[model samples]
Target: MAAPDDSEDQDALYVLTAALLTPARFPAALGDDYPESCAALGLDPYPGGYGLVIGQDSDGARWTVVVDDVSLVAVAIASWDCGMEYDLSPGERTVVSVLPGWPLDLAVAAPGLPAPHDPAPEPEPSRDGSGQDGPTAGTALRLPLAPPDTGTWGPPQRRLGADEIALHWTQWRDRTEAEDAEATGTAKRSEVAKEPEVTQDSEATGTAQGADAPGESSENGSPSPGEISHPGIRRVLGELRAYLHSDTAPPLGRVRSGFAPDGARMLRADGPGWSFVARTDDMAFVLLDEEPGEVLPVGRGSELPPLLKALDAMAVRPA
Candidate 1:
């Protein structure tokens, strides 16, 4: 077996995180001997002090378990453009943790992680359209037990429930709307500054002509389907939606999501072409014609902590 690269680790982490966070029940195989177990799963344990165990569940979700002699330290899951992690403690016989944007009803538990520290509550939109903090408590389950063999790993078998699908769609819609508002405001300001002063007669005639012009065709008046409503949120929502519905999840090494200080959602994708921050109702827009590998500036100082927080929570890199 060969040592895993960052991408491999990311993929495995995403699978593990999803399994741990969701309500699905899949086979979890465990082994006391790290190298032996990894070998069974076609992996080699890392040379670092931590014992690395990799495996796949029946649903095709890849899992990476990091352990020390005394306890399981962490687990990760990856599929497509998403990855997640959960830190564990040996002392806790049972642990419960919540994924930030997910509903409390979907919280899942594992055996190894210690009790999670209470994070400050984030206000989320309720069904009534009022802001309410989601409950912290989630459903509980045991950590993956050792499977009989390594070849048992396969893709997820179950489709997401309506509630699960709704959660994702709502989040995407809210983020997109926020991004669009900011972009619209900026565009309006730019247009105002560039508009030439017209004579009263010309202004009157122009208004009348515009009124008679059959209100521009929908195709020309509205944004095209390919155009993102907000450049700041960029492709984060699109990428996430695709990942959720994909039969095979891809390795998403750079995309991450979280909440802002004012309790608004935020997402960021740091790709080779462009890196941007999309906060609820605000964004750092990029030109459509921007070249690949172009390093665009994002938020700074106090404005950046939330994005960093989201990235860190997603475990884009090692915590």
Candidate 2:
């Protein structure tokens, strides 16, 4: 279909504005100069088919008036925050205008197609018990992760054996115990009374010998197999199970376990398109992917559900 003429679009914008905005609430003039005013405020004017005007009241509060020529049925007047990108609130306003400072971050639909933000009736509840505002099931949420390089990722390997998993659990437990002991020692030292003492030559020699004495042994004794009941570890495992069972679950491979230099147990999922890792002591999950390579930290318990949903949406089939 041929595009509407510029004049026709502008007229529609005016009509939309009149229908939605009351004169008392959004008293602002509109004309060709609307775009120019946006430029004066250090913002880019809405490209063709839209105009904008800023209105300030006696109290110094500001309002942004926006008219979209194309929609013809909707316009928006919203309270303005100088630091924020301008957008309309629901019901009271239906159209959005892009003004300068930042480039317009519009999500344009296909030509002649309605965009996701198109004015519509109130959204209905989703089947998954989440309302329309919540994420849809089966959609992958893009996480912040470093972009994947050109090199090919290797084939998926077998899952970690029971012995390897046990080793990681042992490391994690030993580290936790060591930390507890150090903390207890510190508290005790702080509470002890300081005393002055007279020292003979023999006593001085003994003190020097003690100072030179070997420190405690650097050994991490293993715990029994049944002792892997750390609350944090159990929570992580539970969340992992939920992810695997979800409808949008990614094709997760075996668990790869390692230890950090500080003796923390690091567990990673071998998968395509995305990487998941968590430290036993951290009690949180980190998602990595190609989009921005940003590390997203997902908290435990309640936060895991939404995060797992997002992870499912972002997962892709392996090459």
lDDT of 2 at 196: 33
Global lDDT of each model? 0.34, 0.34
Best by TM-score: 1
The total of clashing pairs for model 2 equals 10
Question: What are the runs in model 1 whose C-alpha is more than 4 Å off?
Answer: 1-255, 270-276, 284-319
- Which digits, one per residue and each the tens of the lDDT, describe model 1 over residues 61-120? 334443432124323333312543344223322322212221111233322332222323
Model 1: how far residue 311 lies from native, Å: 13
Query: Please, what is the TM-score per model?
Result: 0.24, 0.19
